[model samples]
Target: MVPDGLALPDDLEGSRNCGLVALSVVARCSYAEAVRAYTDVFRSAYQRHPRKNWKGGTTWSLVVKAMASLGVQHSHTEVTSAVTLQRLAQFTRRDALYLVCTTGHAQVVKNGWVIDQRGAVPVEQHWGRRKRVTAFHAIKED
Candidate 1:
């Protein structure tokens, strides 16, 4: 399961904030809270709301720092392109949690399901099935 209430809230409108949405779902926080956490990392408070004035770019380093701010234990890794989103599930332990980043998007994968802007879906059926995994993080579940 994708975890209860992990889906992006309807109010989020879900655009240009893939990293923020993924962070919100993984940390089980409100979309507003995620925005706060993310902007706090780089002191970009002026553009707190993605829909309003978000700059629309989050690097892997920013994700790491933001996760830390939220007290979400995580570790980052760079992987080969051979590890497509589908292949990622194959190598992932069934009990592990991950925030998989592709060329320009992110998703939360756990227990063989992926939760993103569109809600939860099996890894194979995910919209980014063939998206090459650029980098990924192992999120320690509490």
Candidate 2:
């Protein structure tokens, strides 16, 4: 459950397509379809590729390709500084928020939370203290 004093936006929780693979799956389906497709593909992808190395782990390129395969368009931005929740808030609302961390890990942000292959949690709890965000992709519907 979301923590107290954190008012999640209406659009946030319902549309959380966390994790690189999960985001890719969301891109494959229509917005309506994505609501039900959450994390389904992520589980399958991990089952297929359990390794976490560069070649085996989920990467931004892979996410891009997955989205492309479904005809989704997106724009990428490289973040030079530590990306805070405030910085992320500046982005225009889109279908999903794909973030690449300095550690080379990728996750998705929706509403005010971060959703990954493992599960969903508040952004501050998931990324507020750990890895620095290195880049972001604003996904657009085709």
Candidate 3:
């Protein structure tokens, strides 16, 4: 039997049926949502991946060029190299967590968030309840 909350049609055909179509649509929507949630993180890391920005228009090419650029006469090739695509990728991935944490929207915390019936401001618990102030009494000293 078809369960509630599902839009499966009873008259579904063979493998190429409406149920399958609905299932695919639901799956795609779910996948899209997951992708959207993670895209920012991916973008943050992808931008810095060394491979993404190597000279000669490619990281590998840049590495090769750098290796060859040094005159053969040099006794020892520069053990170090410029930022490669791999390095860039590593850099971005390392920073992605911090970037996302620092870049996202601000979350306001009230004693309690309040919304009016019309969804207007000053909703219940908007600002914590205002307390009354009482005066202190002091006895007169001789």
Cα lDDT tens digits for candidate 3, 1-142: 2112223233333432221222222222232332232333334446867465312111222212222222111111121334322222233321111100001111111112211111112213323213211111111111
Candidate 2 stretches with Cα past 4 Å from truth are: 1-20, 28-55, 84-96, 99-102, 127-129
Q: After superposition, how far is residue 126 of candidate 1 from its true place, in Å?
A: 1.1
lDDT winner, 1 or 2: 1
User: Candidate 1: minimum summed lDDT over ten consecutive residues — where?
Assistant: 45-54
State the lDDT at 68 in candidate 3: 27
In order, candidate lDDTs are: 0.78, 0.51, 0.22
* Model 1 lDDT, full chain set: 0.78
Across residues 22-113, which tens digit of lDDT does each residue of candidate 1 receive? Answer: 88877878778887888787565445655654376777677778888999998788995477888887888767788989878898887778
**Candidate that beats the other on TM-score, 1 or 3, i.e. the better one:** 1
lDDT of 3 at 119: 18
- For lDDT, candidate 1 versus 3, the one ahead is 1
lDDT ranking, high to low = 1, 2, 3
Superposition TM-score, candidate 1 onto the true structure? 0.82
> Which parts of model 3 have CA positions greater than 4 angstroms off?
1-29, 50-142
Q: Quote the lDDT for 71 in model 1.
A: 90
RMSD to native for every prediction? 4.2, 8.3, 27.5
Q: Pick the candidate with the highest TM-score.
A: 1
